[model samples]
Structure formats: C-alpha cells, structure tokens
Target: MNVLIAMDSFKGALSSERAGKALERGILRTSGHQTTVCSVADGGEGSVHALAACVKGEYKTWQCRDAFHQRITVRTLLFKEGESLCCAVEAADIFGLHNCEVSSATAATASTYGLGELLNQLHGHAIHKVLLFLGGTITTDGGLGVLQGLGIRLYDQMGNVLPDDCNPLFAFDHWDEEAFQTVRKKLGDMKLLVGCDVCAPLYGKEGCVLTYSAQKGANAMQMHKLEQQLHLLEQRSARNLMQEGCGAGGGCAAGLHILGAELTFGYELINRYVRLEQRLHTADLVITGEGQMNHQTLQGKLPIRIAQAAKKEGIPVLAVCGQREVDCIALTTYFQGIFTIQQGIYPLHEALAHTEEYLEETGYQLMRLITMTAGISHTVLKNQKVTIAEELCRKGKTI
Candidate 1:
C-alpha cells in the first residue's frame, strides 16, 4: 500500500519535513510499504519552509526585527512557477507571537514592522508574485507598523509622527499615503496574495480584538482599548472593516488589503503551490498530523484540510498528533482514526523534546496494526470456512 506521510510542523519541536521523516522511519521499520513524506503547512509559522520543500526552492534570509522590535534573521522562499519568479513569506517568522511572551504588554506593543522591512527588500528582485502567509502574529495595530515600515508616516491628532515600534492603532489619526503609493508603484505588476484562514472582520463583536486579543495576552482593559483603537482606525481609513479575513494576523490582512493584496484561504493557497490534492490521488492511505488537534482543527487547520481532501478522493486518513484536545467523534467525519503520540505524562518541555521519538513509535505501531489487519483480511478471503481465531493460530499469531 502506498502511504503518504504529510505532517505539519510540531510547533517549536519539529518541522514538517523532520516530523514526516521521523514517522516515515517508523513506518519503514514496520514494513517496506511504499511511503512518501510530504511537507505541509496552513500558511502560518512554518509555511515558507513547507513551500520551499515542495518546490525545491532556495532560501533567502533577511535581517529584520521581530514582533518586539528585536533584531532577527527571517527566511523567505524563492521559487519559480514556470518562468515567473515567486516568493513565499510567512508573517509569523518575522512578527510571530513566539517572538515574546504572551502578555498584555507584548500584545499592546507587537508590530509588523519587520515584515514590512522584508517586503521593502523585495523591491528589486523582479519577483512576479508574493505569497504572504498571514497567521500566528501578536500585533493588533491593524497593520500600522507594516505601513510605517513601508515608509507611510503615521501621525497623531497633533500631527506628530508616531513611532513604528509600538501599537499605534489608537494614536493613529492619519497617514501620509505618498510613500505607500510609491512602494506600490515600485512593485509594478507583482501580485500580492495574503494567505489567511480566519474570516473574522477587523473590529466588531466577532472581530480580531474581541475574539483573538485575549489569547495574545491582552487583559480586559487592553482588549477594550484595542477594540476602540481598531474601531477608530476603521472609521479613519474608511476601508471595508467587515471584509472576510480582515482580522487575520490582528488586522494585518485588512492593512495589506489597503496595499492591494488579495486575501485567500491560507490552506488553499499553500495547497495550490504544493499540489497536495494531486499527490493524494495516488495514495492508498494518508497519515497527517499537527502539534495539537483541537476544535480549531475543524475550523480548517492543516491536518483537517489534508483529511478533507483525502476523504473526497476516497482515501482513508489517519492522524497522529502530539496531543488530542478535540472530541474524536467530531473529527471522525474527516479522519478514519486519530492517535496521540504521548505515551506517558511529562512536562511540556520534555514532551516537546520527545515528540520525534513518540511520533516514530506511534507510526510503527499504527503500521503494524494495518499490516496485521491486511493479513487477516487476506486470510479470511482465501479460506471462507476458517474462523478468524483459527486463522490467527494457524499463522502462529496471537488472537
């Protein structure tokens, strides 16, 4: 049987390729069943790496700031589609939440300036298109920092320029669009595609601030302030505040929209580049996973997306994760089986460090089950008169 091992990154532990390869090791240990390891992502933290792996692209690293204005090296994917040069950038890598501790202070200060700086460097690359994966960010400044980094000046009511390092969503009264327009003109015919999974609007009851800010470590007061600030920015810019996916990356999507970006589903955008569906067509069984399986998985996480595609093609999919936080019954609609790699309780750090070992063991065990089941089925088909228990004993196997 042809088995496809496609796993998303295990967060801070293993990357998509490394995790898939570890699982591949276990599967091969069980038997020499054909296995293919595919790299996958949901346009979030590890998306650039996944795309690079899929297309055999080269990496270009840029010196940029993190969400907290700390100097960091960010990697971007440089690949070609036909003759057109394309680039893939993951917002999380430059301005991701992982840059700092999740707290009200961090939530209130995070910015996307680093991402903008990276984009500024792309000016003379002659790139035909850019895929900006907008997820896993902590900034809620409505992309003000990004605009600032791109040379758009933000001013307060007093007409004084606001700093780009802090969240200026509230202090933002107006901006100089001349620099923004110049940056746009410099790109010429290059297409900017924003890959985001959420459909939350910019600022409303279900918007970025109220729905996601708390998780980013915003306290109630910070949340209230963020909401009001986002509302003010919305009214000031007169952009469509209720546009689908406007809330992604803490209103970063809406901010990019002002710069002529086309918002698309994160998973689908990556799928188009990776050709996951085309690969699925040839697989008999698919094994996919992520770091965690939770309610959010149903809302279009990478593994669920892979499972949905496999299901549509009548390919059974099994998932193995570091942990399972969602009900199995609900996930059963997409996945035939769900397995967890953790064998015993451990601290979060230890658990993360052992993810590779756990995944390999889980894969080996799962493949063993499949192999034994296939053997039993073959025996039953060959000898209709023999009972299953008798067949097992005859084969010198335990029932």
Candidate 2:
C-alpha cells in the first residue's frame, strides 16, 4: 500500500518537515506501506519552509531588526518571475515575544514596514502575485504601523499626523493611503492572498484584539482599551470594504481585507499552491497530526482537513497526537485511528521535549493495529468515495 505522512508542528516545537519524514519512515518500515512525506505549515512558524517547498522557491537571507530594534538575520522567499504569488508575512516571527521582552508596550513597534520593504524588493523583480502569511503576531494595536510602513499616514483628532508606536491606537483619526497607492498604481494586476486561521471579526468575543491581546502582554484594562480602539478601527475599515478576515491577527487581516486582499485558509492556500491533493492521491495511507487533536481540530485545523480530503479518496487516515481532549468517536469518523503519545500521567513539557520519540512509538503501534485489522480492513470502507458535486479542490480540478 502507498501512504503519505503529513503533519503540522506547534510553535517553537517540532518542524513539519521533521514530523512528516519521521512518520513516513515509521509507516514504511512497520506497515509495509510505500510512503511519501509531505510537510505542511499553516502560516504560523514553519510557513517559510512550507512555501519554499511548495513553489520550489529560493530562500534569500538578509539582516533586519526585530520589534525591539535588535539586529537579526532573517530569510525571505524568492519565487520565480511570473509566479504571481504575494507572500503576506506577519511580523511576529521577526519580533516574537520570546525573542524580546516588552519593556514598554511601545517596544512592539517595528511595523510590518519591513513587509513593505520586502514588497519593494519584490516589485523590482517584477513579481505580482502575493501570499500573505498572517500569524504569531506580537502587536496588539490595530495594523497602523504596517500601513505606516507601506507609506500611509495616520492623523490624530486634531488632524496632525501621529507618530508610529503603540500610542497611535489612542490618537488615530484617519488613514492616508498615499504610500500603498504606489503599489496599487504601479501593479495594476497585483493580487494579495491573505493566509489566516481565525474567522473572528476585528473586535468582539472572537475578535483578534480581545482574544490575543493578553498574550502580547496586555493587562485586563489594556486589553479592554485595545479592543475598543480596534473596534473603532474596524468600523472605519468596514466603511470601505466588507470585513473579510478582520478577526485575523489582531485585525491585521481586516486591515488587509479593506486594502483589497482576498482571504483564504492558510493551510488550504498552501495545499493549492503545492498541489496537495495530487500528492494525497498518490498515497496508499495518510498519517497526520498536530500538538493537540481535540474538538477545535475539527474546525479547520490542518490535520482534520487532510483527513477529510483523504477520506474522499477512500484513503485510510491515521492521526497521532501528543494528547486529545475530545472523544475518539467524532474524530474516528474522519480518521482510521486516533492515538495519543502520552502513555500515562505526565506533564505537558515532558511530552513536548520527547515529541520525536513519542510520535515514532505511537506511529509504530498504530501500524500494528492496522496489521491486526487486516481482516476488518473493510472498515476503512465506512467512508466510501462519494462524488463531490462541486469542484475537487484537492486536485485543483473542477468536476
């Protein structure tokens, strides 16, 4: 049997490339299944690696400053000419919380201006298509800094231009679009694709500001104030364009949406760019997992999506995870089997540090179960291939 091993890693944890290959090797040796390893990243940390593999793009490294003004070396993608892919990058990877401390909220002020810098360089290269990866952001303010970097100006209540920093949230009055006007004016056919995981709007229960602000060091009061500021920004932004991904990355998604960016699932976007379904069709089985496979996993996480896709082809999917809080019945409907890495009671830290070993063992054990159920292999038939009335997104083909 043929199989594909695809997995997504947690932030600051395993790399998808490593996890995919590890599962592939384990399945091939233990289950006698011919396997292919396909690494996937969902616009979080390993996104650069995933995109590089997908388009066979080259990595170009350069020195840049973090959110704290500390100099660091960073790598960006270089796709071929006429590729038409715009890469929307979140500044968090460069100004990650772990990378720097928030001495003052103002310390989180690098601006995606670096993103504009990348765009300028790409424009010189004659590139038009853009894929914006929005994740792991450190800023809690509305994306004014990014707009500033792109050459837009922010004005205060008095109509005086405000400075770039966290304080703009309080003093901002309106946007000046002169900077990004060049991008629009120069590239008539330019397209912006935003990679986002959250569906929350700009400011509310699920909005980016209230939900993610604390993680960026906002206190309860600060969170409240930031949420109010973003809410206003969202209202102003909504006046122009429909709120598409407003809830993504602290309303950064909303900001981009207003700027005429199209929103797509980060994983799904990567899947299309890489022809993920074509790879799935070639596999006999599929092994996929994430850090925690719970109820939320069913809500558009990479592993669940991969399982759903494979199921349409009658390919058995095995999910191996670090832990699971949801029952297996619901998950088993999509997966051939679901197993956790933890054997008994153990701290989460212990499990993460030994993720490689636990994952290998769990995969090997799953192979044994598949072997025993050879007689009941027909159970895999539970999810028979049904004709999807719409286009086959996996194949990039319209049915």
Candidate 3:
C-alpha cells in the first residue's frame, strides 16, 4: 500500500516539504505503507518556490514597485520545454499585503502597476504563454494599474493620460483608441492565464469590492467609493462583468479578462503543470493538507483538489492541517478524514513555533488509528475532539 504525502505549507509554520516528511516519519513508525512526499501550493504564497522546486524553472529578478510603488526587486519564473515557453508571474510578489501594514491606507493606495510592468518585460521575451499567479496581492485597483503598465493609456475627457493610481481609475474615460486594438497583438499570440482560487464575480453583493475589499483594509466609505467606481467602469467597459473569478486578485482577474486572459483555478493548472494525477492515482491513500481547513478549503482549494483527484481513483484521502476551524463533515464525502495537528491547548504562537513537533505527533497518532482500523473495529468519531480523545485512549498516552 502506498501513502502519498502531498502537503501545502502551513503558513508561518512548516513548509509543505517539511510537513510531508514529518508525516512520513510517523506513518513509517507505525504503518508499513509506502509513503511519498510531494510539495504543493494553491498558487497563492509559496507558489514560486513550490513550482521552482518541481519544474526546475529558471528564476529571474527584476526591479519593480511594491503595492505602494516602493522600489523592490521581484522574482520571475520561466519554464521552457522544447519550443514551448511558459512564464509564471506571482502577483503577490509584486503587490502583496506583506509589503505594508494591512490598513485602510494600504487598501486605498496599493496598486497593480508593478505587475503590469513585469508583464511588459515578459511581453517581449519570446514567450508563448504567461501564467499569472493571482492571490495574496494588496491591490483593489481592478487591473487599472496593469493596463497602464501594458501601455494602455487611460485618458481623461481632455485626452491627457491619467495618473497611475487606483483613485485615478474612478475618473477613467475611454482607453487610448489605438493602444486598445493592438495590446493583445503586441503580446504576440501569447496565452495569458490568470491562476486564482476564488470564484467571486466582478461586481454585485458577491463580488470583489463587496466581499474582499474589507479584508484588504477598506473602510466603509472607501468600500462605497470603490464599489461605485467599479460599477462605473464595469458598466462602460461593455464586457460581460458577471463572470466568475472576476473578484480574484481584488478584481485584477476581471481586468485581465478584459485584456485577453483566460481564468483557471491556480491549483488546477499547477496540478496539470506538475502532472499530479498520474502520481495520485497509483496511491492507496493520499495525505494532503494546508495551514487551515475551513470554508476556504471547500471552495476549490489545493487539498480539496487533491481529494478530488484521489476520489476519481476510488482512493481515500486524509487531510491534516495546523488548525481546523469548521465542521468538515460535508468534506468527508470527498475526504476520508480531516484532522488538526494540535495535540492539546497551547498558545497560537507556541503552536506555530513548534509546528513540526505537533505535526509529527499528529502524524503518529493518525497512523495509530489507521493501524487499529485493520484489527479493532472501533468507529472514529467525525468530531475532532472526540477523534483526538480516541487516539489518546488507544495509545494510552496522556497529553
């Protein structure tokens, strides 16, 4: 029996690789099932490193602006195969929240201008495809800054180029006539794919401005203004604004759609890019996890995707996380089990600091249950606390 260990980074805790190795350690200690470790990401943070490690892509750095237009150097990923060229650009690296405090100030000021600049550099790099990793960015500019970086002139009624700011996007009139016609062509048959996790559309109650801007630090007034501006732009743009994933990257994906890019779930694309299915199907069990398991994971997240793939092959999947916040009973139909690694009550900081220790303990505890399944026919409770108690009783260990 093969147990494939493909875990995502625990975020400020353990890396996917480290977490997988730790789980493998415990599994080997109890069950004799073969274990394999695969590092994974959902095209949010740590995507670059995960893809780089797997694909052996060349990393290039360029000086660009952060979310606040501060000068910063960002890395670009290039993966080539024969005549096929794919360049992966992580938007968060250019204009992510980590660059500044997540406050109303950052929300109003952060722009995607630097991402556009990065695209301009790649537009002429003999590239056949561009992969835009669209998560963890601190911009709500709706791709306005990106258009500017792509040389799409945003002009006022007087035909003067507007300033490079999200605020200026509200006043934006018609685009420069000629530049609009040729911008996609200028990209020279390159397919632009925006990889995202969310399916929120461009506007309305379920849209980017309404659902996500607050998380980016938009105050009430700012959300109202941003909503109005986004509504205005979406109306005049004459494109279908009700598309799903338009809300991704703070509506940057919507703007990218206007600029001729296709939208795809980030992990879905990464799975294909990494050829994950072939490895997944051969396994008897798949162990995958991320930092958190909640409503977010229910929405096409990495662990769910792994579970989906494993399910297709009639294999059971177990997801282990640093913490579990929601009742995952609904997830059990897809995943065999969902467990948290926390052994007992500890401060959040201490749990994070010693994530590996908890992970190893949890992994051992998990395999102990799997071992018991073969002999003792005790049912494992779906409730996390009950599961932990049962594991403790089975091992006769006090926490």
Candidate 4:
C-alpha cells in the first residue's frame, strides 16, 4: 500500500519534517508500504522551515530584531522553484509569544519592525516574491512598526516624527509619503503574498484587538485603549480593514496590505508549492497531523485541509496530534482515525518535552492496528473460501 504522510510541527517538540519522519518510521517498521513524507504547517511558527523542506529549498538566516527590539537571528526559506526567488517568512519569528514574555505592556509596545527589516533586506537583494506567514503574533501595532522598519516615517500635524510607541501610532496624522512610496517603488513588480490562517477583520468587537489581545497579555484597560485607537486609526487610514485576514498577526496583515501585499490563506500557498493534490491521487492512505487538533483546525489548518482533499479522492485519512481537543465524533467525519501523542496526564512542560518520543510511539501503535486489520481481513477471506468449497462438495454428493 502507498501511504502519504503530511504533518505539521508539534510546537516545542517536533518540527514538521521531523514529525513526518517519525510517522514514516512507524509505518515502515511493519507494513513495508511505500511511504511519502511531506512537511507541513498551518502558516504559523515553523512554517518557513516546513515549506523549505517541502521544496528542497535553501534555508537562510537573518540577523534582525525581535518584537522587543532585541538582537536575534531568525530563519527564512529561499525556494528557486520558478524563474524568481520565493522567500517564506514566518511572522512568529519576530513577534511570537514563545520568543518573549508577552503581557498587556508587551502587547501595547511590541513591534513588527523586525518583520520589516527582513523584507527590506530581501528587497535589497532584488528577490522576486516573499510569502509572509502572518500567524501567532503578539503585537497589535497595525504594522506601523513594520513600516517604520521600511523607512516609513510617521509624523504629527506639527511635523515631528512619531516614536516607536503603539499608542502614538494612532495619533500620527500623516506619514512621510515619499518614503512610503519609495519602499513600494523599490519593491515594484515584486509580489508579496501574506499567508494568514485567520479571516478575522481588523476592527470590530470581534476584531483582532478584542478577540486576541487578552491572550497576548492585554488587560481590560489595555484592551479598551487598543480598541479605541484601532477604531480611530481605521477611520484615518482609509484602508479597508474589514477584509478577511485583516486581523492576522495582530493587524500585521492589514499593515502588509498597506505595503501592497496580497492576503492568501497560508496553507493554500504552501499547498501550491508542494503540489499536494497530485500526490494524493495515487496514495492508498493519507496521514496528516498537527500540534493541536481542534475547532481551530477547521479554520484552514493544514491537517484538516489535507484530510478534506484526501476524502475527495476516496483516500482514508488518519490524524495524529500532540493534543486532541476536538470532539471525536465531529473530527471523525473528516479523519477516519485520530490519535494523540500524550500517553497519560502530565504537566504541560513535561508533555511538550516528551512530544517526539510520544509521537513515535503513537505512530507505532497506529501501524500495529493497521497490521491487525489486515490480518483480520485475510482470515475472513479464508473462512469464506472454505465455506464455499464445502457447499460445492455437498451439492456434488447430493447429485
């Protein structure tokens, strides 16, 4: 049997490529089946590396700033799959909660300026296309910080430049138009695709600030402060923040939109590069997984999307996750089988630490079930053949 294994990262445990390999090892241990492993992510942290592994591309690192303006070197993927260079940038590399202690203060002050630095450096090298994976960001600066990195100067009516404060970003009455245009001009004809997993609007009671700011450390007051300002800024900017993905990366998607970037669902972009559809056609079974399997996975997570596609092709799909939160009945509609990496109750940290070991073990157990299933089918077929021959002998004797 041919099995296609596509998996996302387990977050703090296995990367997508590693997860795929672990699963592949389990399937190969007993089945001797043809297995194909593809690294996949839901357009979030580790996406750059995942897509890079999929395309056999080169990994490039950039010395840049984090959301806190600290020095750091992050990675990007360079895929020369076509005539131009395609670079994948994971937004979490600059503004992920894991990278810093995020609080309301951090939420109000964190900047995506590091993201801009990455883009500016790539533009300098005359790169062709850049895929900005806009997911799991802590900042809600509306991309002002991102633009600041690209040399866009925000100004007050009095002509003083705005500081790198999130609050003041709303107060700015104008920006240096020439500088803003220059970056866009320099990036002329270069397509910027912002890969976002969510379709949240930028400003509303249900918008990014109200929906996600609290998780990023915003308290009641900070939430109010951001809501009021985002409302005002949306009015002043005159750009549509009501579009799907506008709330991605804490308004970074909207900010990138201001920079002439097109918003595309993150997995869709990755799927294009991987050509996953064609591969699914020939596979007898498909195994897809992620860090978490929940209602959120329904919102365009790679594993769910893979399962959906596999179902269309009459291929059975199995899912293995680090944590399983989705209702089994609801999830089984999409996945024929679902497994979790956790063997027992453990502290979150301990579970995370043992994720890879658990995943390998889970893969092995699932494959054993497949082996049992095959054996049962063979036994049932043998029984049917014996019964048929016995009936035939009885009929001959009667004649």
Candidate 5:
C-alpha cells in the first residue's frame, strides 16, 4: 500500500514538514508500505513556509510593523514560476491573532498597515505576482490601515488625517484616491491574488464583525461598535460589501479587492502551486490532518479540501488530529476514518509538547489495523467461497 501524508502545521507545536515527517516515521515502521510526505497548508499560519517548501523558494526578510505598531521582521517567500518572479505573504505573520493577547482593546486597535507597507516594499522588487494569504489575522479594521499603508490617506469627519497604526474604521470619513492611483500605477500589471477560506460577506449578520469579532477579543459592546463601524465604512466606500469572502481578515479582502485583487480559496491556490492532484494520483490512500478538527474545518479548511480532492479519484482519505470535536461528525463523509493522537488526558501544554510522539503512535496503530483488516477480509472471502462450493456439491449429489 502506498500512503501519501500531507499534514498541516500543528500551530504552536509542529510545522507541516515536521508533522508529516513524524507521521512518515511511524508509517515506515510497518513493512511493505510505501509512503510519500508532502508539505501543505491552507493559506493561514505557516502557509508561506509550506509554499516555500513546495516550490523550493527562498525567504526574504523585511522590516515591518505588527498589529500593535511594534517593529518586527517578517519573512516573505520569493520564488519563480517560469520567468516571472512571484512572492507569497502570510497575513497572519503580520497581524495574526497568535501574536497578541486577545482583548477588546487589541481587537479595536489591531491594524493591517504593516501589510500595506510590505506590499509597498514589494513594488520596488519587480514582482510579477503576489499571493497574499489572508487568514489568522487579528484585525477588524476593515482594511483601512492597509489602504493607509499603500499611500491612501484616511480622514476623520473633522478632516484630520487618521493615524495608520490604529484601526481607522470607527473614525474613517473618506479617503484620497490620488495617492492610491499613483501606487496602483507603480504596481502596474502585477497581479495581486488574495487567498482566504471563509465565505462571509463584508457586513451584517453573517459578515466579519458578527461572525469573527468575538473570537478576535471583541466583547458584546465592542462587537456592536465594530459592526456599526463596518456598516458605516461600507456606506461610505460604496464598495460591494456583500461579495463572498469580502469579510475575510475583517474586511481586508474588500479593501484589497478595491485595489484590484482577485479573491480565491487559499487551499486551492496552494494546491495549484504544489500540484497536489498529480501527487494524489499515485497514492492508494491519502492522509491529511490539522492541529484541531472542529466546526472551522468545515469552512473549506486544508484537510477537508485534500479529502475532497482525493475522493474524486476514489482514494480513501484519513485524518489524524491532536484533538477532535464531538460535533464534527460531518467530517466522516469525506474521511474514511478520523483518529486523534492523544493517548490520555494531559495538560494542554504537555499535550502540545508530545504532539509528535502521539502522532507517531497513532500512525503505527492505524497501519497495524489496516494490515490486520486486510488479512481478515481475505480470510472471510475465502471461507465464503468454500461454503458456496460445498453447497453446490451437495446439490449435485442430491440430483
């Protein structure tokens, strides 16, 4: 049996490469089974690393500001597709939720200005295309900060320029398009592709503010404020607020769309670059997993996308996660089996620390089960054939 293992990053525990390698180690323990490990991500955290591994790219470090206006260095993946120079940027590395303490104040103030600054820096690099992964961001600023970083000036109702380091949605009155047009011209013919997983619109009940703000640390009152501010921005800008994925990264997608970006599924984009379909064709079984399996996994997450693709080729898919939510039974429709790596109850920190070990054990056990089941199935079929032959002989004798 040939097994293709493509595991996503385990967030704080292990990277995609490390996780896949660990699972590979255990799978190899079982004799006569071939295994292939692929580095993969869903365009969230660690997406750039995954892309870099897939395409053999180099990392270019750039100085930028974090969500809280703190100076930090971010690594951008630089690679070539044909003769065109392309770059991949993970939004989470700039303003991701994991970088800060989640609080109402942080949610209110986190900005994507640094992302804009990064893009501006890329403009001088002669990049032919930019793939911006817009997941795991903590900001709810509606991309006002991003526009500001791109030289577009935002003004308050009093006609004062709003600071770019903070969320501008609440005080935004209007923006000057002249500077933005100039910047746009500077990026002439460079395609900007925004990758996201969610399908939420820009505002209203199913939009960014209502669906994701709380997790970003907004309280009830803050959620209400953010919602109203998003609505106000929608009205002021007159952009298509109802567009699918416009609400991703807290309306960052909408802002980038205004700047002429094409929105696409993060998983699909990565798969294309990695040629996952071609890799899956040779596998007898495909195994993909994430750190956690839950309701969010249903929202076009990486593992689900992998399973969907594998299912098309009639390959059975399995998933192994550190934990599994009781309510994510729907995942079974795609996966032949879902296994958790945890062996016993432990502290969260301990569990995270032992993720690789647990994964190895799980992989070993799964392979053992598959081997045993194959033998049992063969025996059962043989027994059935023998019984049929005996019954036919008995009928012949009676005749």
Candidate 6:
C-alpha cells in the first residue's frame, strides 16, 4: 500500500515542502508503505517553491521595488520552453514592503502593475495557463494598478488619466479600450486560474476596501475614501460581465477576471495542479496540516480539501496543526483524527514556539498507532485487502 502526505505552509513560516517530504519518508521507512509527498501551496507564500517542484521551473532573482518603492530582489519563477502547465504567482512578491515603511495602508497602494508586467512578459512566450495566488498583499486599490499595466486606461469625466494614487481612486470615470487590444488578443485563449478564498465583493462593509484597508494602515478618512473608489471600480468591472474574486489582492482578481480569468478555491487549484487525487487514491492513509486548525480549515482551506479528497479515496486523513481549536465533533466529519501542537497542556505562545518539535512528535505517534493497529488487525486487514482487490478486479478501479 502507498501513503500520500500533503500539506501547505502559511505565510511567515518555513516551507511545507520539507515537512511533507519528511512525513513521506518517515512513513515509508517505518511501515514499508510506499509514499508520495505532494508539496502544495495556495499561492500565499512559498508558492514559487511549490511551483518549481511541480513544474520543474527555474528561479531568477531581480531587484525590484516593493509597494513603497523600496528596493528588494524579488524571485520570479520561469519555466523551460513548453514545460509550464501554469504560472503560480504570489502577490506579496511585488506588494511586500520593506525599507519604505511599516504597515502604512495609505502608503501601501495595491498596484499589481508589477504582476501585470510579469504576466505581459510571459505572454510573449507560448505558455498560457496562469494561477494567481492571492495573499499577503499590502494594497487595497481594487486592482486598478494591475489593469492599468495591462493597458486598460482609467480616466475622469474631463478625460484626464486618473491620478496614480489611492487618494484619487474615486475619480475613475471610464475605461479606455483601444489600449487593451494587445492584452485582450493575447489572453483571449488563455486560462487565468485565481487561487483565492476571499469571496468578498469590491466595496461596502464586507467588501475588499473597507475590510482590508485598515490592515494596510489606512486611516478612517482613507478607509472611507478607498471604499468609495472600490465601489466605482466594482461597478465598472460588473458592467463588463466579470465578478468573483474581485476582492483578491486588493482587486487583482478583478483585473484578471475582466480579462476572462476563472475563479476556483485556492486549495482546489493547488490539489488539481499538483495531481492530488491520483496520489490520494493510492495512499493507505493521508496526513495534512497547517499553522492552525480552526473553523477556517473547514472553509476551503488546505487541510479540509486534502481530507475530502482522501475520503473520496476511502483513505483516512489525520491532521496535526500548530494551534488546534476546540469542537472535535465538527471536525470529525472532515478528518479521521486531529491533534494540536499544544501537547494536551501548554500556553498558546508556548505551543507555537515549539511547533516543529510537536509536529515531529505527533508524526511519530501517528506512526506508532498505525503500527499497533496493523499488528492488531493483521488477519482482518489481510481478509479485507483480498476482498477489496477482488471487488476492484471485478468492477474496475473507477468506482
């Protein structure tokens, strides 16, 4: 039997690829079950690493300015000729701030011009599939910058190009079309896959601007104005017959969606792009986890997605997270087993500090349980295996 282990690391953390590999190797060596590790990322962070592993893409570092115009060398993934199935992009690769300032929403404009620029350059090649990972962005500009970079011009009633700052967001009166011909023609046949979980609209209380502006350091005045601008952008985008993920990367989704991008759950895109189902079907058991396991985990996060796929394959999934919230009953429906790094007794801060040790410990314990269970059910397991194999032989593997 083979076991598959898949997991994603959140932003501000070490890469999950190492952890997935360690788990796969451990289970294989301990239980004699072949193992496959699908290192996955939902485009938040560590996305380039995940993409590189999946598509054999090469990496290049260039000194580019961040959202605040501070200099930094950002790494971009480039694939060999005809090897790219999709481009997995992280928003923070461009919007992440460093020397310019610390958490100033007013200063942190969400202009995906850099990302749009990257995509435009990629368009020069024959590759087409794109996966835009939306997370860790500092802008709340409703993706105006991205659209502008792709050659969509925004102007006011007087026909003046809108100011290039968050302050003048509400001044956008209309879009210029002749400018977008190149991008439109190029991406007419391409697939833009948005890796996002944010379902918020572009404006209002639950909208992207109001909810996210404060986090980026927008004052009350700025927040209100930003919301107004986002509302205008949303109206324009909707009139163009594109909605969904309009709130991602401060509206990066809107730019791409207007250009015919398709929206999918972040983890779903990752699982499909990484070929998780095929791996899950062959696994005897599955392991998935994240920085925290809470209600959000059940809301289209990586762990639940993995568990659901494993359930389809009749393979039980176990999760070991850094911070495990209560409500075992609710979680039981998703995972066969769940554990927090708290070790049954520890402060939240303490548990997080020792997360690596706790995860490794939990992994070893899971191995122990599997070993013990296998020993106890040796005969029953053998009989069940034969029965299953016979059924598969009769009905084929599709069922």
Please provide, for model 6 over 231-277, each residue's C-alpha lDDT reduced to its tens digit, 9 standing for 90 to 100: 66657656442344566666667666777677766766666557878
Worst 10 residues of 6 by lDDT: 390-399
Predicted candidate 4 versus true structure: per-residue lDDT over 3-45, tens digit per residue: 7898987766778888888878777776656788887766787
Q: Give the TM-score of candidate 1.
A: 0.87
Question: Cα deviation of 328 in candidate 4 (Å)?
Answer: 9.0
Model 6 TM-score is: 0.75
Estimated TM-score for each candidate: 0.87, 0.80, 0.86, 0.84, 0.89, 0.75
Q: In candidate 1, what residue range of length 10 has the lowest lDDT sum?
A: 379-388
* TM-score winner between candidates 1 and 5: 5
Question: How far is 185's C-alpha from truth in model 5 (Å)?
Answer: 3.8
Q: Is candidate 4 or candidate 5 better by TM-score?
A: 5
Count residue pairs with overlapping backbones in model 5.
0
RMSD of 2: 6.7
Local distance difference test, each candidate: 0.80, 0.63, 0.76, 0.76, 0.82, 0.62
Using alpha carbons, what is the TM-score of model 2?
Answer: 0.80
User: Across residues 222-317, which tens digit of lDDT does each residue of candidate 1 receive?
Assistant: 888788888777776777767878888999998888777899878889888689888876677789998888765665678888888886776667
Which of the numbered candidates is closest to the native, going by highest lDDT? 5
lDDT of 5 by residue, 94-130 (tens): 9998735688888768899998899988887888999
List, in order, the clash count of every candidate structure.
0, 14, 0, 1, 0, 3
Q: After superposition, how far is residue 27 of candidate 5 from its true place, in Å?
A: 1.5
lDDT of 3 by residue, 173-278 (tens): 6677588768867764788988886767877887788887887888998888888778877876778867877878888898888888998888876776567788
The residue pairs that clash in candidate 4, if any, are 104-217
Clashing residue pairs in candidate 6 (N, C-alpha, C atoms within 3 angstroms): 105-216, 105-217, 110-139
Q: What is candidate 5's CA lDDT for residue 64?
A: 88
Which whole-number lDDT from 0 to 100 does residue 393 have in model 4?
Answer: 38
Model 5: residues with Cα > 4 Å off, grouped in runs = 374-399
